[model samples]
Target: MRLAPGADLPVEVLERPDFPVNRGALCGKGRSAPALLARDVRLTGPLLRDRPGGPLRSAGWPEALDRVAAGLARVRAEHGPDAVGVFGGGGLTNEKAYLLGKFARVVLGTANIDYNGRFCMSSAAAAHRRAFGLDRGLPFPLADVPHTGCLILVGGNPAETMPPAIRYLRELRENGGKLIVVDPRRTRTAELADLHLQPRPGGDLALALGLLHLVIADGLVDQAFVAERTSGFERAREAAMAHWPDRVERITGVPAHRLREAAGLFGRAATGMVLTARGPEQQSKGTDTVGAWIDLCLATGKAGRPYSGYGCLTGQGNGQGGREHGQKADQLPGYRSIEDPAAREHVAAVWGVPAGSLPGPGKSAYELLDGLGRPGGVRALLLAGSNPAVSAPNAGHVTERLRALDLLVVADLVLSETARLADVVLPVTQWAEETGTTTNLEGRVILRRRAVDPPEGVRSELWVLRELAARLGVPDGFPADGFPVEAERVFDELRRASAGGDADYAGIDYARIAAEDGVFWPCPAPDHPGTPRLFLDRFATPDGRARFAAVTHRPAGEEPDAAYPLYLTTGRVLAQYQSGAQTRRVAELNSAAPGPYVELHPRLAARLGIADGEPVAVTSRRGRAVAPARVTEAIRPDTVFMPFHWAGAGRANSLTNPALDPVSRMPEFKLCAVRVEPLRSQQAGAEPAGADAGAQSAGSDTVGVDAAGSQPPGADAAGSEQAREETAA
Candidate 1:
């Protein structure tokens, strides 16, 4: 095969005799992944500075690991384990992600370790685990999406976000499946919907409850299925009654008649499924909102079927895997709660660590950030893979506290925004330059083969962390042997960790992955074929019955008022990935979405005296930012949308409210109160103005925004800082 410019040469390019060359399909992003790997500026060394916010100087492996180990030891010894927090990113390999959680609990003896998965999918996870006795991602393959008779998409924009999933949706639509989209904005996905219910932000629960209420009140619910397969139905039904379509219409802005029609269509369908994404989860009431959606599925008898289930479209590539590997604050491997004695004991026995050594559930992302800069709070942080500076909620407060940390260590492939604030920066290998396994959205485990050697001086995160473990004198009993080594060893550890769990993969090994493109989990042995779907008959619950959780509607932490009358919703643009650390560097990707721009309804833009390409200021209680406004009817009049991937002058997080869900602890990234106004020429000029052109001059150094609206030099630094603040909080 011919190589792209600067492409890393693979060890061998053997031709497959049986399979055709074009057998496998590639999405747009996947096709671009190879070119991205060839880009310059990949990090390849360890760096350290003498003081906080000081210049970074290159250091050897030994020196870098020693400094990191010594600093962690010092913090633990002086301020206790809680003083040191570890933040993880979802982009990490399964092996590295697993070790990160184990290192925090055992090596540092700190409970304060959580990954960006919390912000991406925890509420959906919590809801699924509660209702189905398991969280099996989509519960079915993407192929099944088109077979369903009815598809209800809530709080997601799969058409813009997940293009492959959108293809399946389109196929389903073409094959007679009705598509109903529920969201505050009339997103691109909504444009294709048979019906689009524009709910008010944070009103997802009310909408869901209203659906269930209609299904129950009109006798459209499946009584036989509910009675035999579920418990707690009466309580959920009672709660739903209070949120009838008429009442919910007032709260959600979705018309009463439309709500009733949508509910009836979904309830009467032979196979119906409801899907959600980051939109519903990144709110103060995210968990309950998710629970309400689950209730609808249970009431309508839509779950556990081949073409039906409650789906939370995971955001990160490995968000589902991160949760399964115990990167959450309160979880061990296999979705076991850390607080559960039995679960804790099971994991401890597997890892050869005492149960007492594993701390209970710790502070969540929001709480950790709130504690930063406070007396006796987190003094140091170790960040990996995640860029939080431009992504985390309440960007203004997080920035202030981030500069106050005593020690900050960031491990990443580039100088991301958060990494710029680091006391030490460890260069790490990129995805194409490393070998490992990653679980996709449908729980399919695919191998990530190394196409080329890592850049000079750059090391895999596994190698760096293993060296640190040795220097720190962590007991050899920990799975350190798998470090700085082959991907097979890491896969072995993962298999062992998942033994006897719902996501068991002990039977499959490295050899099988090489021969087969991928396999779903629960392949307990070599001869056992992988299970494509989960929960075919009964749930994992003891009684073999799914439970209907009672959920209540709650308002967002902040509401629209005279000062900030517009509701601000944050999301992604087609060209930029989350945080825009890597993709923004690609010229073609950045060219499509050059900089931050507020998406407004034409009506709202007219009211606010704003126009396309005109500068506008969007202000919230937490902070404010200015960006060019694109007036279109894609969104509702009362709501405005902005991509959170951009930082610096138009950082969306800066204007996002920091109110967190009580259960998920995820910030309200989806909904916040803001006021938008046309930016005067003088005001626009007074601000540090260049989309990407002058991004390197001032605060742009922190978020990595270059002068041309591309990722700035140290945007990875901002990512590291954001990760630290979110974890330490």
Candidate 2:
């Protein structure tokens, strides 16, 4: 890697190719990271808005911290400790995650603390624990994909979303392994597959059951393996049997022949794997959807063996490790349940507090945000590493709730849409400017070294937490000098805190990780080598057996109806990352992906009188957003795809459903019912259409094709109420 002085600051050049996993292959996002270092869009110092509708003024650190402390203290004094809520992001380092949890509980004494990671992999996490008694995303490394005989990728598009990972899939094909893809869109990844099964949106559960039924009917089940290493086969078999070929074909758009083909390839392989991503795991029934796929692997004897298993393609920088530690509502450090007395005691001792001092688990991500400003709800919120105002489901309504808060503090590198609405915004360090540890999809913990100094007025999250703690009457608890800002110091304490938990990292340190490329978790002793692959000899269950979930197919929480006849599915584009707070600012990335667009089949666009690059409006029961039409045959005709990376009228999340999965509490972001309308040429820019742009200048809140086509009276209000009611439950 080389660094050269560029426009605003020194830029990072090409990366070292000797690194494993990515192997020096920088995706658009990776290569463009230096682009995010621009000074113009960055929050160089703290900005404070003294009054609700007042212009934010730059302030010194002391003044800003004082105001934030006073505001939070006032809320805590008026309402209660829980009134001051804490929201984190999945991009936070392990040290930051652990410390953020500590600050919320030990300092603020609040139970309201959670992160955006809940929306990423909670469904798969729930399913993994239910069957294998643990969750680690992937049990094997990317290196193993080439050795497998077959790879079934469900609801994932890694070619565009994760470029480096596509190498493994390509290598799998090179080694004579077959690739089967299940998604509504024929993504770049699907184009590389030997077989692509484009099932209807929210129909993944049915498709998995159909494949399992074919596997069982063809006598492809590993009878001996199922009998010896697994249990509950009869119940799972009965559930899968109920989903016959004809019935499954009716529910999912996939044909019977395609199901049989996918089943044959997976079952006949000597060593195979099933990998799932957000596509099938962001619905109300996402747990069961993932469980069905896991059951197929278990029944076919593909799991718990070398080069054969089920895995999840975790998105986000540190999504895998973020959930493993304390930022989650229900989890303590090391993936331990906060409700468990033993787990609480262990963590409490590590934090130098009594077990009883710890608060019980709080609400999940969406629930936490939805409760803001409601009766008996949180009042003051401290946000870090997350921008839910644009990334959350039913985002328009979420933005409204955020505005209703008494005080909202945001810590980020840039002035994201969420930060625009904050009472105070604090500039913080990011990727190359900070040193931390992130566990990748393969569960390998690697260190990210700092390459450049953050601009003036910028600070690390650790420093901010220490300062806030002192101001909040915890000066003794967190002495500025004692509370370390160095990443290694924080990780040292984290190692002790995670000693005996499930995702243990006690014996692993910065030195060891750097020396070995990376080390896998559950590395308890100093001399003990990290476990690269799990479930080789026995499952994690008490009986050393994997349990099969008796899951059945179910419809999405919000299905297409007469009023909203087309299915709306949201995802990522090649040129942008999640939320687009950082990526959208990069000139190169923005030039390629300038704004959000509606991707619908040419037939659907033709029927709606929409042309490629023409403006179109997509409306759901909750809200509406307008973007340019991208007519293509790669996606299903009945579904419309939009990337949730932009804000204002181009924000796809504005029209997304917020129906939560009962088990994982993950909102149904993958699929929702929506109606598409072609906008007149003269009315193309009637609504906002770019990143960070404001809503319709017409000042009317409703979004529709024309003035006469506005939403029915009370519709927007009713939808907002319904969303709040659902989230409250």
Residues 210-233 of candidate 1 have per-residue lDDT tens digits of: 988998888888888899888999
Model 1's lDDT to the true fold? 0.76
Q: In candidate 2, what are the lDDT values of residues 366-395, reduced to their tens digit?
A: 998999998788899999999897899878
Evaluate model 2: give its TM-score. 0.93
Off by over 4 Å in 1: 2-23, 475-485, 525-528, 681-729
- Taking the candidates one at a time, how many backbone clashes does each contain? 42, 0
Q: Determine the C-alpha RMSD for candidate 1 after optimal superposition of all C-alphas.
A: 5.2
The lDDT per prediction is 0.76, 0.84
Point out where model 2 deviates above 4 Å.
1-7, 12-14, 476-485, 681-729
- Model 2 whole-model lDDT (C-alpha atoms): 0.84
The TM-score of predicted model 1 comes to: 0.91
